[model samples]
Target: MNAIIDKLKMLKYVEVTASWLFANAKGRDAKTFVKSPQFASYPEPTIQITSPDCGASPATLSPEYMAGGDGRLPGLEWESVPGVKQWLLICEDVDAPLPNPICHGLYLGISKDKLSVTNSDFKPENEKSTRLNGGFYYGTNRLWIPPRPLLNHGIHRYFFDIIALSEPLDEKLAASKPTREQLAKEIDGKILGWGRWIGQCERVWK
Candidate 1:
């Protein structure tokens, strides 16, 4: 499925022209979406998230992480915040040509004791890694879906937002395998703190 999408994306002329035709269409931004839950502003003493593979915030993600390449999830690390018992991590494309921000990955049950996850750790469900073996479960999207923006669709921003929770999510809720929207609503004021790292990507063939 992804291979087909990648192939279509390579049709640079078709993609660029189609994208230009729908230039007025809009996509949701993560910044604005976060405001709905009033999680808009980070609370005092926020954690700083960074990706060694993707470099610093607002950095450009390599093709290997996109559908055109290996589609591996970027490795990420962050400072541990006190009193966080569990964590929720969401990777989203704020510039996707959709009404809502597209969720690339949603994970729950991240133990606070774990500070980082390497790219190799995220693999096919059949081939599990230690990080995933730590009782973590994927959300609606299930696993990482590599970003594959259309050619000339302009640059797309991926926001890796991790929320520190004072307690673990409800067992029933976790079992439901909720979507990003559902998970965000469930977390609400339960947030202890949060951090975000941004990586940008674009499909351009010239």
Candidate 2:
């Protein structure tokens, strides 16, 4: 039994060494062959949002709720970006049924002063109710409709984009459901930095 244990330990060490060697080789190859793009040419700085000190899980929609109708999760907050005057919130599912990704939610002109928002927090009655789907702010929509691709389509990655702008966005401009293109045009060369949080939703039903 002692001999068997010793052999297992040796095997573990060998496996770790092999993995380390492979990773080193891959790094070397990438450095040798890959011509990485400069940071200046990138669209925007990507900041990843994670749970605070207690190690909280990323915001997630309940499977039961998702299957039923409601698909919004609560408990979302982030630290203010260093030099943001205005912000844009975009939630997209990268693993859609093909063609293109699914846009779950797109919220722009978020007030920088407000940090956190809870579930059903967008209600008209709520003090922080901003704007949605153009003019009518229907509070929190209980039924978040995901683009359908039949059944068992696969896992979908939801990217919640928070963009910090150099100038404050005009309220009139944000009154309508502005396209990403339009937003980009308005904030062209004015984007200071950006951040994102990712959560995943997968089809569990057959």
Candidate 3:
């Protein structure tokens, strides 16, 4: 009976994998057959900032940041890319064990003069006080505190995205801590480049 159940599970996995491959293959083939010259043009790559190091994939529990040591927030750094008037920081957990990714944090209109910020730097009284969602201003320090009964979900990948805009945004908008939708409306076409860092985390304890 156990063997039969295992075989059924394996079959289901195979079916899902095959279906995904088939869909992806068809999409690639369709793209290749497109004759439009406009479709041939590829967009330029965006500049990226990372923690530990760019392109370095580490578990969120790594010692890179104090909070991340226990599946919390990670430390971050970035290279100075040319033509970056301003930057936006967005973090999402792709492996949320759900249909859609979960947002961890977001900061927009980061000044070019600012270099690196640690988990502690995100505290309410820190320099970015106004950037927090509410007037309370929960910076990296505060945001890292896992909710009660710590979520025991599967591995979650935190995507730290940085977008370099072509033009500087209005100072008023930056100070107000606008929603992502608000920023999208003002800076959609003005995005000159962007970058991202991905880190994984999981709650091992139930």
Best by lDDT: 1
Q: Taking the tens digit of each residue's C-alpha lDDT, what string does model 1 give over 36-106?
A: 56475563327798988888798898888889798878889998888898988888887776667787888
User: Model 2 over residues 1-206: C-alpha lDDT tens digits?
Assistant: 99999997776566555444443221111111001222133344355454332123344444632544554443356778777776666555555433344555666666667565545544344434445322222211321443332233344455555666768777766655566556656776666566566565444332
Off by over 4 Å in 2: 1-48, 51-60, 64-69, 124-150
Arrange candidates, best lDDT first: 1, 3, 2
Those runs of model 1 whose alpha carbons end farther than 4 Å from true positions after fitting are 1-13, 24-27, 30-33, 38-45, 124-131
Estimate the TM-score of every prediction: 0.82, 0.61, 0.60
Residue ranges of candidate 3 with Cα displaced over 4 Å: 1-45, 53-55, 62-72, 126-152
Candidate 3 residue lDDT tens string, 1-206: 99999997776566555444443221111211111132132243356566753246444444333243443455677766677777667665554333344446766667665555565555554455565422223222324433111134344456666666668788777666666556666776666566567676443331
How good is model 3 by TM-score?
Answer: 0.60
Q: What TM-score, to 2 decimals, does candidate 2 have?
A: 0.61
In TM-score terms, which candidate is top? 1
Model 2 alpha-carbon miss at residue 176, Å: 1.5
Instruction: For model 2, state the Cα shift of residue 164 in Å.
Output: 0.8
Give the clash count for each candidate. 0, 0, 2
Candidate 2: C-alpha lDDT: 0.50
